[model samples]
Target: MRIVLDGISRQMVDRKVKAGQVLAVPGPSGRRIYPTFQFAADGSLLPGLPAVLAALPTRDPWAVLNFLVNPDARLGGRTAVDLLRDGRVDEVVRAARHLDDQGA
Candidate 1:
């Protein structure tokens, strides 16, 4: 099944992602955006995100936020859009394995 993300959610996810950022499936739809931190893994906002997000203003809406979103970016990582377009678990898994091998 495909996951749906709103514009704000898309923006947040996009910001969290970098061209070479480490990627881990975490699980199906782990890319979700939660409205509150209570539902997050640590019951706190994703590190180093709110500051930037706050500056942008919360005009967009998103859901099912994952805890894995990284703040310290390492540009050039895979993204949900990339994976969704690929449509191959093996390729994704292999790419992830490679990233793991690279110490992602």
Candidate 2:
């Protein structure tokens, strides 16, 4: 699931919070959609999520979003967000490094 800037905050979006990962991607008819996982229930970016985003192999929004949602063997078959929620930032960083090294 995704959300537009209006669904979150225009100011945060404009500031390119968390390396701009929280910003929405333009879609058909000029729609913008940000990955839902990038935001928490309190409407703040999840802690340490940007670190993984920073270490991503690609800066493309879709790719980075997919990486966050997909399961990783290094994460013990858990998604990046799951690890982050569990306070396993080290593992997430390692997973990001592995992806960077593998050119994924």
Q: Best candidate per TM-score, number?
A: 2
Cand. 1 TM to true fold? 0.23
Candidate 1 global lDDT: 0.32
Candidate 2 residue-pair clash tally: 0
What TM-score does each of the candidates earn? 0.23, 0.76
Residues 1-104, model 1: lDDT tens digits: 32222323645555544421212133446654333321224333333233323222222333112212322122235442233234433443333323324444
Candidate 2: tens digits of C-alpha lDDT, residues 4-23: 54465666675675455563
User: Model 2 off-target regions past 4 Å?
Assistant: 1-9, 21-23
Whole-model lDDT, candidate 2?
Answer: 0.72
- Displacement of residue 72 (Cα, Å) in model 1 is 14
TM-score, model 2 to reference: 0.76
Q: Per-model C-alpha lDDT, please?
A: 0.32, 0.72
**RMSD values, in order shown:** 15.0, 3.5
Q: Note the clash tally of each candidate.
A: 13, 0
